[model samples]
Target: MIKIYHNPRCSKSRQGLSILEASGKEFEIIKYLEKELTSKELLSIISKLGIKPMDLIRKNEAIWKSEYKGKTLSDQEIIEAMLKHPKLIERPIVINEDKATIGRPPENILNII
Candidate 1:
């Protein structure tokens, strides 16, 4: 099944969800903030995205700027930070089978779904 890690308050996330709905393919929505992702779960998503853990972070978030900016952190440390502050995670990560993509432009989801 396809899954979307979404934040309803984020415009980009909402756009992504709309795209998925329009696509007419079945998908699951994971409200990561409400459910909270574990370190292992987040790590697995990052792996599917074929990106470094830091690459999946919302670097401009206030929490990132205040707590983790300009720091040389290990991949595990960065993942831990995201777990502690889920807001630091980038929104609308869509996973289809073993493939995943960050729906920054919303259209990006079309490539996967």
Candidate 2:
């Protein structure tokens, strides 16, 4: 099944959701803000996206700027930060089996879906 790690408040996230909806394919919408991702699950997603932990972060988020920005961090520390502050996670990550992509343009999701 396809799964979308979604933040409903984000326009890009909403746009990604719309794409899924228009596709008429069954998919799971994970309201990640409401249901936090566990470390194991997060790591799996990062691996699937083929990106470093830092690449998955929303660097502009106030929490990241105030707490994590300009500081050196290991992959685990960055993962911990995202776990502690879910808002720091990039929006609308779509996962289909072993493949995943961040929906920055929202259209990026179309590739894997």
Candidate 3:
């Protein structure tokens, strides 16, 4: 099954969702902010994305700048910060079975789905 960690307020996330809708393939939308992810779940996502935990962080978010920026953190620490501040997580992460991608460009989802 395909799943998307979406933030409706984000235009890019909306676009990604639109793409999924247009594809006519069934998928699940995880309104991540509304239903926070557990540390283990987030870790699994990071693993499927084939990237480091930090790669999934939205570093430009105010919470990141005010609290997490300029601080050297381990992978676990970064994941903890994301758990504490779900807004710090990047939007529209699409996962399909073992493959996943951060849909910053929106179109990247097409490749995986």
Kindly give the number of clashing pairs for every candidate.
Answer: 0, 0, 0
TM-score on alpha carbons, each prediction: 0.98, 0.98, 0.98
Instruction: Single out the weakest 10-residue window by summed lDDT for candidate 1.
Output: 36-45
Which pairs of residues clash in candidate 1, taking residues 3 or more apart in a chain or in different chains? none
Task: Kindly list the per-residue Cα lDDT of model 1 for residues 1-113, writing each as its tens digit.
Answer: 99999999999999999999999999999999999898789989999999999898888899899989999999989999999999999988999999999999889999998
RMSD of each: 0.6, 0.5, 0.6
Ten residues in sequence with the least summed lDDT for candidate 3 = 50-59
Question: Which residue segments of model 3 deviate by more than 4 Å?
Answer: none
Worst 10 residues of 2 by lDDT: 59-68
The alpha-carbon deviation from the true structure for residue 17 of candidate 3, after best TM-score superposition, in angstroms, is 0.2
lDDT of 2 by residue, 1-113 (tens): 99999988999999999999999999999998999899999999999999999999998899998988899999999999999999999989999999999999999999998
Candidate 3 lDDT over residue span 1-113, tens digit each:
89999999999999999999999999999999999899889999999988998998898899999998999999999999999999999988999999999898999999998
Q: Which model, 2 or 3, shows the larger lDDT?
A: 2
